[model samples]
Target: MTSYVPEYLKAKNRKTVFDLFLRDPELSRAEIVQRTRMSFPTASKAVDFLISRGIVTEIGSEEPVGRPGRRRRSLRFNPSAYAALALNFEGRVLEVGLVDLAGQLLQYEQHAFDCFHQTENYAQLAPMLQAVVEKSPCHVLGVGIGMPADIDNNAETVALYYDRQEVVVPLKDLFGDLLQALQLQAFYGNDVNLACLGEASLRGGAGEKMNLCYLTLGTGFGAGIMNNGAIWLGGHGRAGEIGNTHLGAFDLKGPLQTQIEPLETRINLQALEKAFGINLLDDTVLPQDTQDQMVEFLLPALVTAVYNFSFLFDMDQFVMSGAIPNRLPGLAACTEREVNRLLAYRKRSVTISRPVSAHCTLIGAANAVFEGTILSELQG
Candidate 1:
């Protein structure tokens, strides 16, 4: 007799099968069953569903070199079935990329604004985006936007700092017409959060249950938390806004007592440049003494931030990115040493490292869009 399976279980099994297929170039039904520990019938059903939906394809049988007679039919993920568009909005630059279902970049472009005022009209770049979408090699699944700011509750607006002023731009309203015309789903998220996702993707999607934090030390300071393979957008989607957290004592009697200086004010690239009189972005190399001095000045605040985050979230690993860390060679090791000194008494330790790729934010935006659209649909 056939066993009765609930719809939720079927959906979960489909997702598992699909995820496995994505991880591996090819898989057989028997292999899927062996890997997932699912019944052969369930695995077969999921494979059949995926094949029917054009998400997967069955190639010819393959025989292992060692095993002579054991020929298994191979199934491969169909990369051409869907595509995603990723847009990363930094302070004054916008980077766009087209990615396939398998997270391969098909095309990429970057646009830099001459001034802050030019970014007010988000729709100004719509024509360029539309041209890319029309030329996509496959069906466009969705668009993902990674903003260098906090997105509001409605997912319709983002609050970004530009020219020493905070501006709220209507995200959905800006892209509404373009998305409607393409009939594509759109997702907006913090750029750092997407960078964390991109870093996780570099690990081949193996950091699902791990508590990973992506700390960015750039023009402004922020962090992205990834727990159990998902972006941990805490209550109100502002979990990684560590820039606003105060690190020093407050003045009880002063009018600005409640408005203590935030951690970002002391450790960002601007602060470093102000303190050392050296532009971090410039190609001119600094003397050993200057580099050491800069490291000494930046290390304490970074260590303090790491300690606070590790203590609060019990982080397993910290991935450092952004303008400063990428520019300074040894920043990661120095930060790690400081964190080690601070957490020496504790039984647990958190690891610190740098990003695997320079295009982490852009790749992450694409991955987020693909996962949010394709994986979400499968799981749902």
Candidate 2:
């Protein structure tokens, strides 16, 4: 029983046509109709609308088929027609990026927030956004912020975010000026959730009907969930907060001293450092086979997370990201294998993949504003 949504609500066909241009360098009208399974005229109408908005442009024509018949014009997604101001907030670092429609980061600037040298993050933020917006070559769509915090999607605000020193940062209140000063809208998303969105855009699959989860294993264990090309923030916006789940049973020669701790507190970099009695992720120290030891250590937490996400969200695709997991290539395969063993009775398929680019969070922030503003306008 698949519930149907109105075309105007989702703009299913229009977005499908537009997404093809982003994935492919150029496309023909006939090709769009063929790939999207839309009627010829329907494809043409969407293309015409995009062209009228300067979002899509007719560059030239394709090679004539057979006997040099009438050449069909080639259409391309015009990235310069609009751009988004993307901001990614880590504990101490703030990454400000100017991203075009094709997810290209045209310009990027990094700023330290709330540090001793930069105690005034709010003061530096407005200027940073203004500087990025001033240098854009096209119309600025809006601002997108990706932070490690709970985002209230309905209210369009970051509910809670803390700095490295555990100082509270009211993300929504801080952005009031940057957006208003620049006369732009703002979209807030969880950092990992935005990463998933960035990956989905890069994959450029069939429009809508997309379900994905991105597992992060850097300083902490977390996940980003995506459904229908949007971050599935769930009620109250804590959809993928897997860190606080208590440890589940698994085989390990030596477990952490505080085994009763939450899964995230147990598997994070700090936890591993304390568990292994050294900096497990020290700079320039790529452990030899000891990396395998690290994987074996976190295997229980990783397996449990995948199983929970697969069963709760019922998604078959999971992507593993962050410094530690990405460094260990076998981590994903091992986790997928264990999770499948758990789901063998159900006969369900689950796969764990790795990241294609390191800049997913930045690109995903840009994509948020693009979908909410530009795509909506195009649909209308």
Candidate 3:
């Protein structure tokens, strides 16, 4: 970590050049030196390192602005220089995608399976993922999977949630064949956390500091927090368990030992179905008042979470994702209005809404690979 260390200096210089290309997408050695205040030789060495790694490309040259005679070779960050295979298992189907260094989802597909056929899940997606890795046209960074489960970073495993319960499994063990065959790194996390990270990347998180929170309501409620542009994973990587946070309690269920209930018990789809006597997720039923009823039922719980997150984190943006908000427009709008009103009283501004892209989890899984690999040097 010392400045006098040669490796440290070299890594630092390469990072500086890498960041420059990210900002401008194209830069000559002269331009890099001028903007970075580094000497010509230092910039050249850094650019050379990136080029050798295939991350920097010489895309010809052009006179930039006023320098008419200064037509030097232009170098750009090659976004497709490395790729990550991203897979999202949303309980039933696996949403697979291929992503490049630039955070773009280059390819995507889905493979459906029965909840009971859990053993066949990863094994089934192997071919599709293998095909993606083979055709990636660039070095494979790794494979990152987002699933409804608890992730153990140290253990390199996940306890996947499916068929209404969690089954402990090492994700790498599931994809061991493909991973070993392709010689790729493996990354995985809770689907909601990945979604939050994905949203941050889309919002230019790479270049700035941000405190953002993402909330999703489904059969299970969850929250993902990004503080200062980095995921706020608590010591155990389980910080955003807002679902288990208590917003309210009632003695109606039991007067003695089990009277209290967590917010998730009330905010999830089962609560909605129990109150409405219909499956909210089932699209066949056309109940005219379904949306209205859903909005009212979820408003209080949603307000509680948003209010707490906004007040505690001081984050201005909240992306409330998941099928509930995406399918029911009224619910998203109501959550926004109610949460904003509470925050306005404290002179704090916040925007509560849905994710801009549907492929958020997929993209975020890919970003995890980049964070661990290509961006790791710059981050340090």
TM-score of candidate 3 versus the correct structure, residues matched by position: 0.81
- In TM-score terms, which candidate is top? 1
lDDT of 1 by residue, 59-122 (tens): 8898865766777889988977877888887766888888776666888899994323423555
Q: Kindly list the per-residue Cα lDDT of model 2 for residues 137-161, writing each as its tens digit.
A: 9988898888877777766555542
How well does candidate 1 match the true structure in TM-score terms? Answer: 0.86
- Model 3, position 73, has a per-residue lDDT of 88
Instruction: Report lDDT per candidate.
Output: 0.78, 0.78, 0.76
Judge candidate 3 at residue 255 and give its lDDT. Answer: 75
lDDT of 3 by residue, 87-123 (tens): 8878777788898766788888887754333366445
Clash numbers, per candidate: 2, 0, 0
Off by over 4 Å in 2: 1-10, 62-71, 115-121, 161-172, 247-260, 326-329, 341-347, 378-380
Which residue pairs show backbone clashes in model 3? Answer: none
Evaluated at residue 13, the lDDT of candidate 1 is: 68
